[model samples]
Target: MLYIVSALKPEAQAFVDHYKLKKSKLNNFTIFSNYNIRLIISGMGVENARLATQTLINNFDITDDDTYLNTGICGASRSYTIGELIECGGVNYNGIDHIFQENRPIISCVSEEVATPSYELADMESYGFYDAVIHNPAIKQFHIIKVVSDHFEPQKVGKEETKSLLFNVIDDINKIINF
Candidate 1:
């Protein structure tokens, strides 16, 4: 079974609308399930993410064999044009090194071991969840998928819009699931 995790209820509902899953909640955690897929709208922030993930794992009895995904929107590099979907190969936190192009300084993904980092180019959560739950042998696959929502703009993406953007790409998400 695949366990999908998102930061908001809208994103979760988007998946539910398409899949037509059963909706249920546990201690305020919204959950939806369809066949082999389970989606959880975990709210926001790393701490909230930890709680949600742990609750899902405990309640659903998720193990290492299940696919775990952290999907959401995030800030993109200034050099990266808006509306681009970038896969997170690795996450680097803390200070980012400047990339030089045409004598102009450009910010980009930091070159560092995924094992060690402080701040990531993208991702609001999953680090804590990965760190906490990844040691189990039952976990077969873990992936981080995110779309660029803004170029560090203050604009907030409403629930409906986020649903439209994410649900439209279910094929891509399914690929990730299959992978």
Candidate 2:
């Protein structure tokens, strides 16, 4: 199974449309799923991401072959173009760094939305998703994939733009999942 956690509906809409997933309520979460994939909207924060991810974990039977992914849009520096895909190799949350992969960008998960480029990349939910998923022993494969939606100006990002950014990277996301 490929379990996905996205922070907003717009972020998850790309996958739901592409996969033809059906919407359903899972406890307090809004989940979209088919036979092989389960995607959840974790809302827009670290705590929300943790709760939503934990809810999914509590209801599912995880295996070594199952893959967990946290996909969403992020605020990045001008060096990254809008709509660019970033497979975060590590996440920094509240001053703690957790490395997942090597030679890739490190995303700083913040408690609130950022308007300035204080970090190379910033998002509201990655660390929360990571916090929940890291504790699970049955799952082995996991990834945090983020799309650049703004150059530190998150206010300019709209629903349509968010959907478009993620839609463009569906194939890339699949490649990572299959890898």
Candidate 3:
């Protein structure tokens, strides 16, 4: 089973459409799931990401075979163009870092975007997602894939733009999941 966690409805739309996933209500959260795949939208924030991830994993019988992935669009430094795919290798939350062994790894500073620094990536959700899931005894894989959306400018981000940014990396996300 593969579980893809997203932060917004737009971020998850491509996968839901591509996979023909069926929507089921779990509490107030919308879960898009098929036989072997589940996509949960955490709704943009550290606390929401943590709570939503914990809720979904708790409600389901996650096993070693299942893979948990957090997929979304992020605010990045101007050096990275919009719509670039980044497979986060590490995440920093409240100055604490969680490093991973992966390809093209970048550090994601998970927090509300204010003045985006030169960090590889910045988002409001990844740290919370990783923080909560790391405690789970699922004994398997977890990855973070984010598409560059804003150049550290929150005013430039909108729902339509987020959808477009996420669309650019759906193929990369598909490859990651298949691999």
Per-prediction RMSD in angstroms? Answer: 7.5, 0.9, 1.9
Q: Any residue pairs clashing in model 3, and if so which?
A: none
**Candidate 1 Cα lDDT to native:** 0.63
Worst 10 residues of 1 by lDDT: 105-114
Selected candidate, larger TM-score, 1 vs 2: 2
Instruction: State the lDDT of candidate 2 residue by residue for 19-110, as single tens digits.
Output: 99999999989999999999999999999999988988899999888899999999999999999999999999989889989998999999
**If ranked by TM-score, best first, what sequence of candidates would result?**
2, 3, 1
Ten-residue stretch with the least lDDT total in model 2: 170-179
* Candidate with better lDDT, 1 vs 3: 3
Off by over 4 Å in 2: none
Model 1: residues >4 Å from true position, as ranges? 63-65, 93-120
TM-score of 3: 0.89
Tens digit per residue, CA lDDT, model 1, 80-112 = 544455555554334433221133222223222
Which lDDT tens digits does candidate 3 get at residues 15-117?
8877899999888899999998888989888889988888878888978788888888887777788888888888877777778764556556555665656
Clashes of 2: 0
Question: Residue 116 of model 1: what lDDT?
Answer: 27
- Against the reference, the lDDT scores of all candidates come to 0.63, 0.92, 0.81
Q: Estimate the overall C-alpha local distance difference test score of candidate 3.
A: 0.81
